[model samples]
Target chain A: NAGVTQTPKFRILKIGQSMTLQCAQDMNHNYMYWYRQDPGMGLKLIYYSVGAGITDKGEVPNGYNVSRSTTEDFPLRLELAAPSQTSVYFCASGLRGGGDEQFFGPGTRLTVL
Target chain B: QQQVKQSPQSLIVQKGGIPIINCAYENTAFDYFPWYQQFPGKGPALLIAIRPDVSEKKEGRFTISFNKSAKQFSLHIMDSQPGDSATYFCAASPITGGGNKLTFGTGTQLKVEL
Candidate 1:
């Protein structure tokens, strides 16, 4: 079902630059999420969407934005990138409720210089 | 607030040995716990999960032991192999709302030597 897919497998951005990490799921999941993983650290949520038009901030949402215009797409935007933003980003999708298991994408390795 | 806490930042085990990774949480609202395993350069994948109603759940060579009173849970790998080496993360979610809003603990890197 192509569970979850993310674009730009790897990327490097200069300070002040901006980019969007794309995520899609064919499972028709109603919940989508964006998370960042630092070296030797657990993943921290950046943003999430309950549905196409409902988005909310998570643990670490600074310097990031998200849009869920369609059930299949949830993209994360990083504006004015900073070195501290250098980390691996993952996109996941799940069913409607909180007990559902999430399907994750391969991940995008982003470097902000 | 670091809702979930995991210990043994790293572990090394001989082939065929059993490796256990531990985690604890402070939130009583969390009723679902799941473990994810991630290899280098890859995203984390669900291994096994247990709810507070069950004390143990086993899948293949992986097992999850949950303790409701202690607010703790653990993952154990039986007859560990080199392929089992990876970073394991324990996550919890509240019983309400979007269940996928997981609170993850620091990962435990497991290495199984042949």
Candidate 2:
């Protein structure tokens, strides 16, 4: 399987601009997640979905949104981007939601200017 | 609040040496602990993981030691190599609320010199 895949390996957005970071998994995972990594800060969950049509906020959900339209796709949206949003975003998928192995995509490097 | 804490922002060790990275957590609800390794410009990958039930686990040259009473855990790399140089992260997750949503600790950048 391709596992999890994310689009736009890199991007730079102006303040107030918006963009969507796309994620997909071929493993048919029921759980998908969005996380941001800032240098030594490590990964922080932004949003996650238990399944299609069920999305919830995570540790750092502000300034972001997510939609899981299908088992394979979970896309993260950044609206009115700010410089504070500059970080590397990752998309991950897992067979189950609790303490299971998560497969991560290469990640998208986003810079808000 | 940062529920997970990792130590040593960076570490450098020679090849064949054993490097240990430590982590502590404040959440008692967390039952699963896992470590992820990220290479430059790439997403993190699961290296090894352990549950609180097990005090220690070993997989190949990577090992995880857990101290339930101390709420602390550590990862040790035996016979480290240059290829093992990467950012390592310690993460924890509660059993409730879709258990896979992890809270991560600050990463430790490890550099193994040949």
Candidate 3:
């Protein structure tokens, strides 16, 4: 299996611009999550989905949105990007629940100017 | 507040030496603790994990030592090598509910020198 894959390995956006970071998993995991890692900091969750059509806000979900229309895809949308949003974003998926080990994508390095 | 706290922001050790990274948590409800290793420009990967019920778990050269009473845990790399160098993160999750969302600690950058 390809496990989890993310697109646009690197991206740069202007302030107020928008873009979508795409994530997909071939493992048919029921749980998917979006997290951002800042320099010298731990990852902060942006959003997550327990299953398709069920999404929830995480600790830092202010400037982002997510949709999990299928078990294979969970995409994160950044609207009206700001410089504070500059960070490396990761997408992960797990078969069972939050207690399970997650498969992560390579990551998308995003820069907002 | 930061639910999880990791220490020694960075660490450097000679090759073949053992490196230990520590972490502590405030939430007693957190039952699952995991360690993740991330190479530059890559996402974190699970290295090893421990549950509060267990004192220690070992897998190959990696080990997780847990202290339930102290509410702390640590990762130890035995006979460390240059390839073992990376940013390590410690995370915790409640046994149930919250969709298993994890609270991550500030990472520890490990460097193994020749």
Candidate 4:
């Protein structure tokens, strides 16, 4: 069913380069989120959307931006990416109510040189 | 405050052995507890979950035990196999807050060897 999918399985960028990480879901979920996983930092939320056209900042939103253009697409943008921004990024989606499980995308591993 | 805390940054178990991972939460408002499993390059998947109203929930080889008073929960992996080697994460969210937000633990890396 392609519950959730992420693009650019892997990428490497210089300290000042910027890029986008794409995430999409086919379950018709209205809630979507972006989280980054570091060695010991668990999963830290960077941004989230309640529905298309609505987005909000999460715990770790610095140096990152997100937009919800469609119910199935939420893309994350990194501006002036830094070495500290290098981490594995994950995207997840679920029903708005949220007691239900959130389906996660495979992940995007980005290395900032 | 970090709402959730997970123990044992890493663990190793022999095949067929039982591996347990514990997690505790400080927010009493959290009514939902979920465990997620992540492979080397994959996103975390919902392994099992339990609610405050229930003491335990089981699905095949995985189980989640919850304790409301202690504000804690745990995941028990029975008859662990080599393929079971992966990272486990514990998370908490308040059902009242529309529940989409999940506060995750640092994670536990489990290695089951033959």
Candidate 2 lDDT over A40-83, as tens digits, reads 78899999999899999988999999887788899999999999
**Cα lDDT for residue A68, model 2?**
79
Q: Which ten residues in a row are the worst by lDDT in model 3 chain B? A: B94-103
DockQ score for model 4:
0.70
Candidate 3's fnat? 0.71
lDDT of 1 by residue, B12-78 (tens): 9999999999999998999989999999988899888888999999999999999999999999999
Question: What lDDT is obtained when candidate 1 is compared to the true structure?
Answer: 0.92
The residue-by-residue lDDT of candidate 2 on B1-114, one tens digit each, is 889999988999999999999999999999999999999988889999999999999999999999999999999999999999999999999866673889999999999998
TM-score of each: 0.97, 0.98, 0.98, 0.95
> Each candidate's iRMS in angstroms?
1.3, 1.2, 1.1, 1.3
Q: In terms of docking quality, how is candidate 2 classified?
A: medium
Better of 2 and 4 by lDDT: 2
All candidates: CA RMSD (Å): 1.0, 0.8, 0.8, 1.3
Candidate 3 or 4, higher TM-score?
3
lDDT of 3 by residue, A27-113 (tens): 988999999999778999889999999999999999899998999999999999999999999999988885799878999999999
Tens-place lDDT per residue, model 3, B3-103, is 99999899999999999999999998899999999998788999888888789999999999999999999999999999999999999999688577999
Q: Model 2 clash pairs?
A: A97-B100, A98-B99
Docking class of 1: medium
Which residues of candidate 3, in runs, are more than 4 Å off? none
Error of 3 at B73 (Å): 0.4
